[model samples]
Target: MNHQTRLQALSAFLKAQRAKILPDSVGFTSGNRRRTPGLRREEVAQLAGVSPTWYTWLEQGRDIRVSTSVLDCIATALQLTIDERKYLYALAQESGSGATLLKEQLPEISPSLKRILHELRFCPTIITDRRYYIVGWNEAASHVFLDFEQIPSEQRNMIRLLFTRKELQRLAVNWEHFTKGFLAIFRAYYGQYVEDEWYERFLDEMKAVHPDFNILWQQSDVQSAPEVLIEFRHSKAGKMLFHLTSLQVQGSTDLRCSIYTPVPDSSTEYKLKQLIERK
Candidate 1:
């Protein structure tokens, strides 16, 4: 969508959200003979701590600059959910930075990176780009999760697999937590390519394939990649815990390598070893 169209949509969205919230919802006494269904623009502005005129201008879709903080306040005042907040930002496109589309062809993985994946005997490692496309992975990763090679190239997205693949649901002990974190990280990256055709296509496909994905994607939660503890239910190894770490691939701005290592003092290490031996 173009800038004007986006702003218009955002204006409409805010107005709709505001109309959904009744006066009593924000602790106001409901006086008799209310004409409007929800809180007024002035009331929203008061609750959001912004000027009524400014709020009105925003709702009018005027070309006024808005800060992230003000938008956040509005989101809070409106009691927007995580997904709603995200959708708001997606419409606003606050940063003014342009989105760079991915190349038509996938970038080739460096030979050294491939070797590193191969050499990481104990760690389950996978390489992905900013869009979460699985470009490379080690045998350990294939064993820990499903074999990426077996998945069709177009369908080898981590986020897509998490939601659509039944095996992933069975493997992840805390599926909701994992998916939320993944979505947050994905959102963090999404801002950089919000206008890219490929990104838009992927989002459309995801929404079409998984209804829940659309709900989560709207939450507008953005988080940097972080080290996290995750639990997996391995058919052969039983329950296993890993310290999942994401690191940027050196010399590559967009590529990232993720490694899952057994947590210290856990039987996960032994279990992984056993699983490897069975292979």
Candidate 2:
């Protein structure tokens, strides 16, 4: 979709989702009879910590210079999952262009490569496309993502999960920093497959969620892999920061091998060891 249409869609989507939440669902008692459908505009405004006038303007697609923190609050109010939230940011990126292609399209993952990842199962690993789609994962990687298996087959982008799912937020040791980097990576990876329909659809979804994503996407920040330290707030294992290591697959530039490295002599390692032993 074009930028203006996408922004309007985002505004409408937020309004629709906000209207669906009964005050009781978000913890406000409603004793009066129905006026307009769903919770009053004021209710959502209060819950999201935004002014009612500002919320209305945002819904109306007028003068919304929203910050990530405010958008985060709105996500919480709207009960968006992490994937949805990331999609929201993607749509709200700063770029003005239509979806651009980063990587050339390729056929499906080869059996030989799949076998290799399986063999490397001891390492926490996942094979992702340029869009950060969770194309394939081994046992160790799968174990870290217990909830991932439950996601609808197509909705498997890591950044999306980081925003929409509360469990994802729980898993984030430093969510804000992690998420910003994730967007930067997407921008870097854009040259690979930005023209793909799936990538555009991903952008559209974000536009429906957060305007900030639209702004960021327009800025076109290159998303090459960086020296990343990620904080994983694991459910059973608790929290730790791991350095991320990424390698592009030989034949397919879009496919990547990313490993998580534990810090030396850190409590995180001890935690991982104990967690592994228990399993």
Please report the candidate that would top TM-score against the real structure.
1
Write one digit per residue (lDDT tens) for candidate 2, span 63-167.
457787887887788776564465455444433233443334323678987897777644567777667777777666765654467776467777677667777
TM-score of each: 0.73, 0.55
lDDT of residue 118 for candidate 2: 73
Shift in Å, residue 277, candidate 1: 2.0
Per lDDT, the best of the predicted structures is 1
Please write out the lDDT profile of model 1 over residues 61-96, one tens digit for every residue: 888888889989999999887756776676665542
Candidate 1: give the clashing pairs.
Answer: 82-219, 83-218, 83-219, 86-220
Per-residue lDDT for 23 in model 2? 78
Overall local distance difference test of candidate 1: 0.79
